[model samples]
Target: MERRPRRRLLLHGLVGLALLLADLPALASSLAAWRITRQGALELRTSPNVSLQAFFEAGTRLRGPRVWVDLPGAPSRTRSIRGSGDVREVRIGRPTPDTTRLVLEFRPGTELNPADLRLVGTAADRWRMDLRGLSRPVLLGLGEGDIEGSATVAYSPPAPFPTSGAPLSADGLPVVPRDRFKVVIDPGHGGPDPGAVGIGGLRETDVVLDVSLQVARLLQARGVQVVMTRTSEVDVDLPPRVALANRVGADVFVSVHANALSMARPDVNGIETFYFSSSSSRRLAGSLQGQMLAVSPGSPDRGVKAGRFFVIRRTVMPSALVEMGFVTGGLDSPRLANPAHRRRLALALAAGVLQYLGGR
Candidate 1:
């Protein structure tokens, strides 16, 4: 009987050993063998101050089930860096035992295009994540794809622009000026709020203001009454800007802004437009998008989208926000920095407005 008990214990121990041997594969796979580092953080002095980066050793296959961009200024109490341009902090964490996530925080008034993130494999065993070519706060994450596909896939523009139906009634129709049409033109981010800073220290406010003024002049030449939110360099709040459009009872409202994307992909250049995600604004948005593309032949067609921007949302009439070109783009930056290119952008904006108003 004593021998039987001893044999029983031996069998149990053998079973446990066998199970552990069988689990060796899984245990080995789960081991955190990959080396990760924030090595790119040292090069934060570059323009737009691409302040942070994460690097992973080769063979560390990444699979993200959740990736996104968080635009609210960095969490107030979290670990952070101050005044390194638009980016405030880069936080890394293990949301789960097996998952590692990188979160980028930005200062207020910064923006990021998820597609601008460029993940490059620098060596046989090293991959680098770069954050550059941007002057705004943007959040980007990767999910369910190879590294390259992850970020670009996040920028899924709408497939098609919606068309407008017949005008329901005279009261519902866009207002027409006695002689032609009237429009409210808003140049976004002025004075203190520089909106987005791009390559060679080009400020979004300066570019947009210049374009807005030129658009105003072009519209006036075509017999359209143009009411500008701010005629010169000055700060204009969102509420007051919308209030001016509503007060004038303009037929249509158009806000101008220059686009900024992640510095990693300086090649991403294009023009895009946003209207409220409502059917009422689609037709105008579509017209503007189509006309602008027609004038700028080589520019990438980013398509019209429904955005919940304050100015467009608050305005009573049909409204659209125009993102002329990428100020951080290699091709677009030089073009926008030049006076002739600014005039072309102005012409495109004016033409789009005129087309939507049936003035073209």
Candidate 2:
């Protein structure tokens, strides 16, 4: 009887070990590497074999300004890496058996605002945190309790378009006639993705869609061929938006979006535009910025910037992404909610597109 009991226990132990071994691959995710990009942002890369699940919590801790990234299911490990710019060092440790923690220590006197931190990536395997546009640092005395803030994850890489289309050339450039000038206007976010919520519960999706529709209408009135990525409140991924423009051989691609900051920053308001590659794209961005500023009185001109947003980057044509104004701004929210104001903004956008095309 004793021998039989021992044999049963041995069998149970083997089964348990086998189950643990089966789950080892899923739990083997770890911090593979990290580097600071030319933009002065911190980029973190995880093991690609498994999906990454990380929770970032940042604030002024009792010790100082710090950010804690918790990785559940990660193994216990201790390591430290030197940091650049405002970050003094990054320390990796196992806070609990099931949780791996990454502590980011900032230089003394660094004013860490959660709003300035933006985490963007398509997959968890690679993520980038932008901290270059931080406001001037201020000395907040240590032990001021926790000034809590959360980082916003934005943007994703473009996926392949769902439906089959005409095959592209060897260079991945679509073959189409350039006889007529074509434009594609994409309104950012819709349906399930309400985008940034602003003052009085104003949604970014609704605002941008209204502005884009008016823009398309005005452009059509001028006898220009216009294509819209979305005409109603429905979800459209970044891939199809870019594919449509490329397949049709559009001359220009413009995406409309509204800016947003924390609710605490009601005073922060501005108009900015983004473009990727080519001097022609830069010119388009400049034209849009100027016209929008001319009509949007009292709104600060945030200028044109280079951004690698999926829609703007993947499109073959000269493209620009315009952030009309801050939806969270005290001044901008009311104006954006007004149909007449949106109409004026639309007119300015249409005029900007015409201006760019005219110069071509």
Candidate 3:
């Protein structure tokens, strides 16, 4: 009887100790692993891939200026990855017990928007911070592009650096083209996603699709192979749209949308073209914006902007999101409603693509 009691006590002690040991790591914030993965560009992913687990508790504010986190408790030493792409190295710093910051050092002229840097959940306990827009410092060489068919072929960054070979554009930078340049055109809203409703009850989905189809036709006629995310008014999820463009190895991706301002401020209207924060993407956007402005000389030019929209951000090609006109703006609404105007916009967009493609 004595021996039995002693054994039970020992087992209980061991179990309690094990539990305590397990809880120890949890007491201090645990950062599992920091690793890099690449699609067309490199991204830093946290182990367990979720948000900083216990490190950042509730009320922990994610302060900007630069990415710094104020946690409930102190975390381990800062984690670092040496220079890659636009990132010289990304450091997770705990300068003080309650304050932690993610310090990203970028090379000169590398544009980084707070909106572009994000923590996206990848798995049950995992999340990924995609920095593709800010940097693609290295290319592992192009994947075999010989695979037949657009649905099967996946295009990658050419082995040469993005700025290495090819004819200089008007801006005087080398832009290499795949064997056959391909373009993906995404119509903004479809199916149940009617987008913005404006004067005379205009449906954004219908108007955008009509204009997108026209754009596709013009590009196709110009001998530039074109892929449409949807030809009919059917709902297409954003992921699949991006996947289609990536799978086909698109040279350029353009998402067409019509703008809508507040009902109260119906007068705010113009053409705004957005690109991811990259020189190539910005060049593409500028080209398109210029062409649109030239064609619609009377329309207000909202100018080229930068954004991390899903279609443009995810696609590993020169991509842009074009907002043709404001459906709610009294001056622009009537023009967007006109079929001729839509056609002209399509032609202008096609011209922009051609210009970006070395006027081919």
Candidate 4:
């Protein structure tokens, strides 16, 4: 009888342990299901000073089950957001278009750490990640199969905004001017890949998309056609992107993206330009960098770099990728998330296109 009571307690204890073990996976599954969404599509902007904002694009919905969304001028931070069913009001802290920032919520006990960030590049724009609690040794890789376990993935960027800088051909023959050039803007990373996330919940793709549209509009207004690789929120592969660019006979290809880092106190903020592996690409990158700095005064010049990006590597025309800014640095995030700063960036890029075309 004495042993019976003790045995009963032991049995109950074993059952409790089993139950606890069962619940762990459930907890993890629940954690995996936690998601984030924006009511209308969020606008991406470049920052000036310490300001960041997401001007809402009404009727454009950006809904997903991802952990977080990035903003301009911020580093990659993971989060889970949801709505209260009916037309949920999304708030970003500024009154003006350039200063407003959207708000999000997360599960209780979730940690927000700034130091756990590492920068990884997608096909074009990149992410500044804080992957402290998201599994271990988080990674960012390319290819469709074998995605790293628990690692975030990025989507291809939207089509580049077309250029109106068609002046003359190499033979001194003037290139015919179209009403609007059909430009395919590529904003890299989507779906599972939240490229970079910084303060005010900034995202890499979100930031590039905003700038891409602005660049598109600027060129369209100047009588150029514009097409986007992935207009809404969708993933695009490299081969398809290359085919699209070639299909449209893109006069110039510009991939829009942000930059990131992975180090202690690695506050990296600067502007870098890239072209395919060619001598002329260097000149184009240099020219674009100069033009970008013209509008963004006091910005760091990382100089033109040489890299064999898949999109740039495969494209047959003049192609370049622009790293507008970084989201992780103390001084960079605010600079990236500001609307004025983005506008200036767009203007500088436009001027660069003009110069490139005029020179030819």
Off by over 4 Å in 3: 1-179
Error of 4 at 158 (Å): 14
Off by over 4 Å in 2: 1-179
TM-score of each: 0.50, 0.52, 0.51, 0.50
lDDT of prediction 2:
0.63
- Tens digit per residue, CA lDDT, model 1, 1-360: 000000000111112111000011111112111211232221111111011122221111232111111111122232322224445555534444433334444444443333433332121111233443444323332111132221210101111211122211112122334446778888876544567778999888788877777777666656677777655444445666677688777889998888898767788999888999666578788877886676676889988998888888888999999888888988778887887777667767777777678742
Cand. 1 Cα-lDDT: 0.53
* lDDT (tens digit, per residue) of candidate 4 on 221-310: 555566566544334455656777887687777777887764233366788888877665566677778978777666688889887777
lDDT by residue (1-360, candidate 3, tens digit) is 000000000111112111000012233443333444445222222222112311111111332122332222345665665655544555766766654445545555554444344342222123344543545543333211221221221212112112111322222122324346788888775543468988889878767877776666556555557777655543445666787798778889999988887867777878889998889899999999988887676789989988878888888999999988888888778888887777677777877887888743
TM-score of candidate 1 versus the correct structure, residues matched by position: 0.50
Give all candidates' CA lDDT scores: 0.53, 0.63, 0.57, 0.47
Off by over 4 Å in 4: 1-176, 180-182, 263-266
Q: Which candidate is the best by lDDT?
A: 2
Question: Candidate 4: lDDT over CA atoms?
Answer: 0.47
**Best-first order by TM-score:** 2, 3, 4, 1
